[model samples]
Target: MRHFLTALLVMILTAHIAIAQSQPVLNLELANKIADAAQEKATSENWNVVITILDQGGNLILLKKMDGTQIGSIEVAQLKAKTAFEFKRPTKVFEDMIKGGAVHLNTMPITAVEGGLPIFKDEHIIGAIGISGVTSVQDGIIAEAALKAVSLN
Candidate 1:
């Protein structure tokens, strides 16, 4: 009876470990959710903007440049998202650092400009989202909406 109980406990612990390993990471899902929500809000507001989602590794996850948005905005948004993900900081924050004479922005192979935010999940950095076109301020507005939609940081 004692041997059987010990084997049963081991099996249960193994199963739990396997389940934990099988859980999907949150970056992709958060990116898709952010992009979809940004697009929905932009459409309703007639605000043409490019939304970009990038994983923590700076890889593109999703992108949407709304109709009427400038073609160049797409690349800009991508760069912004990539910058935020790679640096794990908001692109605007990097820009501010540059303005403060950080002089480090040039060394990074990323755009340290506005329109990017670190996508957060429970205080963890999962990915990032960026917005462009219209105005820089509007970019923040849309991106914030996306974050709020997903209840992410």
Candidate 2:
């Protein structure tokens, strides 16, 4: 019985070590940098917008909205980032899924719209950032700028 307990502990410890090494750490400073880059991109076009940055688990890390931007944009950007985090894809993908008659869009607490994108580094999802108060294409562009600013391919 002692041997059996020892074996179980070894297996559990091995699994724990593997998981810890496999996981990526997405910190607040990185999230903030992405949000700031996106905000700069959007504002550079004379477009005031709201930006929301979320960690891997879809929790808000940072949120900002330029003055004169619509209040509704704040919630919109948060939802967009959350949607991307949950879906593990760009927010436009949800829009496509909805167009394909994906009923889950209505069922799930998600927005099948634009303005959100996954931040992948070293083939792992680090976080996501979203922008609102602009056109869908512009939103994507701003996100692209942020990704570039972070040098995250």
Worst 10 residues of 1 by lDDT: 20-29
State the lDDT of candidate 1 residue by residue for 51-92, as single tens digits: 988765557878877888999998899888877877788888
Q: Which pairs, if any, clash in model 1?
A: none
Evaluate model 2: give its lDDT.
0.83
How many backbone clashes are present in model 1? 0
**Candidate 2 structure quality by residue, lDDT tens digits, 55-97:** 7666788888888888888889888888888878999988888
C-alpha RMSD (angstroms) for model 1: 3.4
**Cα miss at 136, model 2 (Å)?**
2.1
Looking at model 2, report the run of 10 residues with the lowest lDDT sum.
23-32
Tell me how far the alpha carbon of residue 135 in candidate 2 is from the true structure, in angstroms, after superposition: 1.8
